[model samples]
Target: MADSEQREGMHYLESLPRRWVTLYIPLLLFLFFLLFPFYWMGLTAFKPNAELLSTEDNPFWVVAPTLEHFKKLFIDTSYPSWMWNTIIISVVSTFLSLAASVFAAYAIERLRFKGSHQIGLAIFLAYLVPPSILFIPLATMIFHLGIFDTRWALILTYPTFLIPFCTWLLMGYFRSIPFELEECALIDGATRWQILTRIVLPLAVPGLISAGIFAFTLSWNEFIYALTFVSASENKTVPVGVITELVEGDVYHWGSLMAGALVGSLPVAIMYSFFVEYYVAGMTGAVKE
Candidate 1:
């Protein structure tokens, strides 16, 4: 029996190297593919415009590094206004979405109201409708409301979809939480609002963060609606402003464009990195429970 066990252990040890190699090869390749664009963007951001345009200069290596592009982007252009507009719209819209979704979700998930389940389903289905189809009608509404070409247009329009998806996500997460906790609080004479604010909201932090991050990123990177609603340069978001204003009449400002994109994406990247674990945990917990 000892000899047989020793042989089995040796076989398992030999198989480990093969299994590790198979797993690592694909993982390394995937990482490379995912990160190469970021690497390219960083290198391009520092490269001089001449080097950027020249085929002789290595695309991966910056021969002549300069801050001229960044200077031009910040000082010589309207990038600051664009960035500010994007930040305000994204933050406000995300906050509004969170506030609306949490209460709506709690109602749908906990309160036994008539047609609550149907309403939840309908909201989720409406979220599934693509923005491409809705943008025209939305544009008309924005125009009618006289908010076209303004940042408030984005703030108002973003929540229409964000609220629905966030509501559904929060509903799932809220349902996963045990009702016994709320029941205990209710027995102690806590009002529904008190229980929600004191207990439920605190417990649902992970889901809230995930939902907020999603909403913020969506609002920040949204291009189609930004383009359709805002025509003025001062009111444009980062995504639309960078593409339209930077690249005019085939004179593409590659270095500045890449720099702008890199900077624009940093906030979302930082947000995701901070809340990534919570986002995964919240989603998994909601699904499993």
Candidate 2:
């Protein structure tokens, strides 16, 4: 009975008020910190130019909302094309990266090849190398390949960063699965390919979704390579297109820019909302020896 009372006290942090102070308040603050930027973007997206520029009005609240900015974004610019390019590149590159990462992760984690530890570490280190430095060489390759200024340039280049990180992440998740499953399949005369597709892939859905979400988010927001490689306005992805094309020399379209940014971010937000549970599980899961 003493132990039970202690456990109950611990479970609720000794009282409701203390629990709310420690847990609920911190969580609310974290949510505000994380979500406030998006909220501000939405507010700015809807506020008219007059209200936005006015010094007298409450800056935090939008007194009036207009869709003119969104209308201008879609009708007056190449934003639709940019949106399409972003979607295509993000999806194609995400799938390509996920596929390559899966195979690489399986090989590194399951194959137990010589120097596998070092190779795995090397792959992760490659992910840590800044894109700012790599884009110079990558730009040269894109030019030499004659794919510069095309959507293919970004689709191809994104995997350079995406694959390594996804591979490292998936390697950990794959390690969480039992070797006995694969061993049992092997004993039943299953080929390596069969074991991978039939046994491993099915169980690794959460990890795969997590990796795909990561790859997609990175590809969607990638700016450096996109800017360096694509010169044409129509070929530019949302991140580059929204920022570069919306501004005239010495002039910025604040309203349209905010609208574009808000719209551009919705897809990623929706993707996360859909797979958040799986992504959390995938990140937290680990193997126990």
Candidate 3:
């Protein structure tokens, strides 16, 4: 009986390696799949045009490393203007969305106004509505407003989607906070506005930060609206500008395109890396409620 028990234990121990292999093999493969494109882009960014156009089987390694592509992008192209336009639009839209969402969230979460819950649900549902459905009407509105073919068109359009979802996310987060803290502040003769600004907002800092980061990244990486609304070359955002204008016909400027893409992605990557923990905590807190 003891020998049988020992054999069973040994079998369980031996199965551990198999279980690990089963779990990790798929994960490793998925990681490789996701990473290979970015790796290839990075490699191609460093390669010269000669290497890029070479009909070589393994174009993964740079034959001659050079900053020439980056130089050309900055010096020869209107990339700087496009980048500046993207920055302004993204920053402005993100800030507006964050401000609007926070206040709306606070009101919905804390105030016992009539139909607040229904309103929250309705707003969230509205956000979930497909952009394709609204783009035509939105474009018509933009034309009537006389902001067509301008970056302001994108700035105005973006907040319509961003504000609602961000408000809902933050409403959930804010509801998770204990009412006892607010009650204590009330006892100390604090007004609702004061309490929100001084007490509640500080405690919900992680959630606010997470919402801000989401808004910023979304606005920054937006391509569809930028493409549809703005037609002027100088007013194009990075994503649309690079892909559309850079490569003409079959003459793909692979190295410069890769370099531009890499540079454009850096800000978003850094923002995510820096605020990742806060973002996770915010989402977790929202879920727990």
Candidate 4:
């Protein structure tokens, strides 16, 4: 009877105040940290230059929001072109990386070849090597290939980083699938290519979405390579275009800068909203394996 009472006491729910301290407060703080930047960007985007410059008005809330910054962003600047370039680069790079990663990861995980584990580890390590260092040699190659200052530079270069990470991610997810499934396909006289396309690819949709999302996000936000390889205003991605085109010398266009950022972030936000389930599932499966 005493042990039963002790067990009940141990398993009892916490009081509201204790729960607030242990869970609710920390969750609220995390949400604030994560969401405050977006809120600030939206607030800054709509505020008039007078309100932005003046100190009297409450910075948290905009009293008189205007479309002037957005107008300038869309009309006065080459934002549409930047948006287009970003989309094209991100899409092409993501697809290319996913395609390559599918094959590489399948081979590493399924082929059961010698040193496959070592090779997989090496690929992930390659991803850890910062792009800051790789860009120098990459820039020279881009120059030689005569793709410098062009969209192709970004499209081609993005896969260099994207593939390794995607391959690593897909490798983990692939390992989770039972090998017996592949064995049955092999016994049924399915060719490796046929098995890959018909069996493996179909089962790995969530992993593919997760890897694609990651590759797309990286390509979209990549600034250093975009800045170095593409000098032309029209070819620049959103990140580079906004910073280079909006600010001149000592002056900064905070309103327009925020507008560009808010607009630039929408696609990624929409993507996450749509595929968040698959992303979580893929990561869970990968980690479990």
Question: Using lDDT as the measure, which candidate wins?
Answer: 4
Model 3 compared with the native: what TM-score? 0.90
- CA lDDT, candidate 3, residue 229: 85
lDDT on C-alpha atoms for all candidate structures = 0.86, 0.88, 0.84, 0.90
Kindly report which residue stretches of model 1 are placed more than 4 angstroms away from their true locations once superposed.
1-21, 281-289
In model 1, which range of ten residues has the least summed lDDT? Answer: 280-289
Q: Pick the winner on lDDT between candidates 3 and 4.
A: 4
Instruction: Tell me the spans in candidate 3 whose CA falls farther than 4 Å from its real position.
Output: 1-16, 281-289
Model 1 lDDT, residue 130, Cα:
80
- Cα deviation at 23, candidate 2, in Å, is 5.9
- Lowest lDDT 10-mer window, candidate 2? 280-289
The number of clashing residue pairs in model 3 is: 0
| Residue-by-residue lDDT tens digits, candidate 1, 1-289 | 9988977675555566786688678898999999999999888889987887788755778877998888889987799999999999999999999999999999988996999979987887877788889899999999899988988888988898889878878887787789999999999999999989999999988788878887787888888899999999889999998998999898888889988988888888898888888667655644453
Clashing pairs in 3: none
Rank by TM-score (best first): 4, 1, 3, 2
TM per candidate comes to 0.90, 0.89, 0.90, 0.91
Tell me which of candidates 1 and 2 scores higher on TM-score. 1
Best-to-worst lDDT order? 4, 2, 1, 3
lDDT by residue for model 4 over 91-137, one digit each (tens)?
A: 99999999999999999999969999899889978877888998999
After TM-score superposition, the amount by which residue 53's alpha carbon in candidate 2 deviates from its true location, in angstroms, is 1.7
Model 4 accuracy (lDDT, Cα): 0.90
* Candidate 4 or 1, higher TM-score: 4
